[model samples]
Target chain A: MKNNTTLLRVITYVVLISTTSILINDIQEFNFEQFKSFASWSKSVNKNENWFTSKNAIMWSYYIIITALFFWRGYLIYGFTHFVSILKEIEKENYFSQKNINYFKKIGNVFITYTINVLVLQFLLSVIQGASFNFFKELKNEFTFLIPCGLAFYLLAEIFKRAKTLKEENDLTI
Target chain B: MPITVNLDVMLIKRKMKSKELAQKIGITTANLSILKSGKAKAIRFSTLEAICEALECQPSDILEYKP
Candidate 1:
């Protein structure tokens, strides 16, 4: 069991490090020049053109939506860090500890929040690109698994809470 | 929470030290302290029996219900 936990910890660390590096790389590769041009464009506005319908406005909206998606992805990664915290608790033989329960709940919150925000951003991106947004089609996409996964984490948290209570009762039994 | 332990009172009546009773009852001194302080959630029947045998008391002497 200890070996299994050690292996799991190693795997988690590897995934976390890789994901962080990838996110950082993506952020670095993002077009800050377009944002700068958008700022300049706002200063030299074409008075006759509708602001919302302009090409620059659509491009700026696209960048903003992309940035928001990246932020949510980073938040999701932060949520994964809680798994390491939980594993540390388990290693100390605190499987049903309050900290573990809280971490599980936190992970659930992050997952659901990330999924919802990403969905909203995707819808906005479609709108900016003059494309139709189908909510059901979007839900059928890659990130949809996170919704049920988040719920499962919540269920796990509740189970851990019950186990913690049972453990306390057992310990206090004399 | 209304249920209180009276183990200390019983111990005083029998003139037995808490540690000695714990040893006689085959429980840790720490656990005996939990019982004495009423921090234990529940007591096993076997442990109560052992305590009763060692302290020469009834369960009612060690446990009490207060309104």
Candidate 2:
């Protein structure tokens, strides 16, 4: 059991590191300089120009949506940190501990929230770019799996809650 | 809980210590404490039988329905 937990811990660490580096790389590739310039432009631009239809307005909205998407991605990565915590609990022989259950619920919330928020951001991005948004086409993407995965985590939390109760009952039976 | 344990009362009647009864019944003193404190959710039939056999008392003597 210790070996299995160690192996799982290693795998989780690898996944966490890889995803974190990828997110960092993506952030580096994103044009923060352009966002800064946009901010400067907004400060000096013609105040009389229509706010909704101007090119600068569209650019600002685009940057805002991209930033929000990045934020949600970071949040999803934060959710992955809970796996390490859960493994630590298991290593301590606390299988149905309240901490682990709460971690599962939090992961579920993060997963569902990240997915939904990203989808909305994508639709908004498409709209800002004057592209048609296809909802079904978006759902066909890989991250859509997070929806069901989130629900599974919620179910796991509920199961752990039940198991905790049963364990307590068993312990007190005598 | 609706059901209450009267194990301490039965122990007094039988002039038995909690540790001695736990030893006789092959259960830990901690578990006996749980039973005595009415903290146990449910008692197993085998354990109830062992306690009865050790105390030489009826099951009703150790368990009571309060509500």
- Top-DockQ candidate index: 1
lDDT (tens digit, per residue) of candidate 2 on A116-170: 9889999999998889999999999999999999999999999999999999988
- How good is model 2 by TM-score? 0.90
| CAPRI-style docking class of model 1 based on DockQ | high
Local accuracy of candidate 1 as per-residue lDDT tens digits, A32-90: 78678667877888888776776866777788887787777789899989989988998
Give the Å shift of residue A30 in candidate 2. 2.7
Output the worst ten-in-a-row residue range by lDDT, candidate 2 chain A: A49-58
Candidate 2 lDDT over B1-67, as tens digits, reads: 8898999889898899999999999999998898899998888999999998999889999899988
Which residue runs does candidate 1 get wrong by more than 4 Å? A24-60
Pairs that clash in candidate 2 = none
CAPRI verdict (incorrect, acceptable, medium, high) for model 2: high
DockQ of 2: 0.90
**DockQ result, candidate 1:** 0.94
Q: Write the per-residue lDDT of candidate 1 for residues B1-67, one digit (tens) a residue.
A: 9999998888888898998998898999999999889899999999999998998888898788998
